[model samples]
Target: MGLHVFGHDPSGDTALSERALIEAVDVLIFCAPIRQTPAVISHYVAQAAGIEREQLWLDITSIKAVPVAVMLTSQAEVVGLHPMSAAPKAATLRGRSMVVCEARLDKWRPWLEDFLAATEADCVRADAEQHDRIMALVQGMVHATHMAQGAVLRELAPAVGDLDGIRPFSSVGYELDVAVTRRILASNPAIYQDIQFENPHVAPMLERLAAHLDTLRDLVRQGDDEARDRMRETLLEQSRAYVGEQAIAEGSYAFERLGYLLADLHEPRYISVFLPVDRPGSLRALLSVFEQRGINLDSIHSSRSADGDLLFRIGVSRDGDTLALRSAMSAIEAEGIGRVVDAPG
Candidate 1:
């Protein structure tokens, strides 16, 4: 990956203007913010009009419709990309997803796919309109829901202290709601606003959401169990139709898994060991085995045994080297310090 990458900041260095930079590169990629993407792309595209048609132009904007449309006007081959992740982390891109909208691809398709494969990122090809449509629901509706929750919570809780105190008594679901709300609120407002406003499908989706909320309120107020049951059944049936019965079943299982994963008490488990707490420094000695082997323990809990001896439960996450964990566990057992109680499937 001996790639020479250059950054062109408008205010920082006026020597290499955007137009000059675009003319110099084989591929011009616009990684500007969502709101500024279309404008930035347009300005560069105008300069690129007289350039060779073989030049490839791309944008990695969250909202694809506008930038894709602008890029289409240029003489260069246009490819709209949206990496379904934040900025690059380290040199590896494994487990990351990149969306590609081939507005006008020729040879650029294979080149782009090969480049993504080298980074080990999953590339998904979609039409520009389809991508924007899905994003409207995926991003726009989701953000709006969180924003609304934040608004209501601000009115109800009113203070940071209240939120901190409420956390101890709240369920994982409530905690997740607050987390999502806060995550959205913490981001740049203009980005979210552009996502919600630029997508034409979002307004209608919001309207439908409003209507659904109103209907649910009415149903709750009526206190009619029969009507509520009927509504629930209808909604479930519609959901099954939309996503298929198998998907519904899988979604339920995923929800349960998510609940367990999100729980404060649940540690990422590769191995769980039960150690005797009666001996002085037994816990420290047990942990030292793992430490010596370079295996990290995520959490350790202690409780009194029925026989009056103390029991220590040590947990290690899957991220710890598996071979090292096994070796450490064997050493602990051989030393008469602990027994491996459970190992992750």
Candidate 2:
């Protein structure tokens, strides 16, 4: 049976078809594949022919201004919500910010408040124009910039042994770029494309930046110090204008918070071997042995090493000594399971 937690809708009511959605729903939430379609509102309106003005209409589009404009004439109290969590494969409402923009927010304010609070979300109230303008930079421009970097790297990677003398050094800026690139390469590309096309302002900004980057690259190749200096100063000035020193300080605070969280969940240390096994079911057999012996594990990380061995770190359970754990592992024929050595010390 279908349940209605908030409203008085009957349980076991058959699901409404698309044609009947507008009439059936007390509130209509429209989520599109992309945020910036001009036809989105008209489409919703037509689908919802008999929907009353008293019914709540909402869209969770990233850029809100266009949706708000379309819904303004309708009798329905319209609101736009943007959830600010970094998208996981399947993200739920938890730990996400839902920014809301409303015309006549008072009418649906209670329902909105109740819905968001249930999910433990932070709610920021803003209007259509303000929301879109912020997103133009936040999603659209940011994605475009990273895409450009990825493109450049793909095009300009050096051949193996080409940089034998070049030392690898790390800096905050490089670390930031690493994080940015990691996100870009790992995520879906369509999301980036949607951000570009959805927001009207994104394309032009990306184009101008791309042009400037090309010019800068040319200047560097030509050994033009004057051009390079000017470009650097302009870029630095823009960065400062966008996010000041205080913003960096705030980021540091967030980093420390993450460190504290890690410490709170920290476990005792032990190690595991990640070598390849000729026999299947080796990992299971080894783990079973530990289980049978009542030897617990702490934290474990496993990855492939450069030499083609599986590398693993298994932290010892707080209650067990290393010797007992090693003995359990030995009974499983740890070496035959491709472990190089038992309890490397």
lDDT of each: 0.77, 0.66
TM-score of 1: 0.74
Candidate 1, residues 49-124, lDDT tens digits: the string is 6774888888888888889998888888888888877554335456788888988878877887777788787888
- Can you tell me which runs of candidate 1 are displaced by over 4 Å? 88-90, 158-161, 264-288, 291-345
- lDDT minimum window of 10 residues, candidate 2: 1-10
lDDT of 2 by residue, 26-135 (tens): 77776665543436666667666545577887776777777777876567887877887554232246556788887756677798777777656678888778887778
TM-score of each: 0.74, 0.63
lDDT score, candidate 1: 0.77
Any idea what lDDT model 2 has? 0.66
RMSD of candidate 2 to the truth, in angstroms, is 9.9
Best by lDDT: 1
| Alpha-carbon shift of residue 250 in model 2 (angstroms) | 3.6
lDDT at 91 for candidate 2? 25
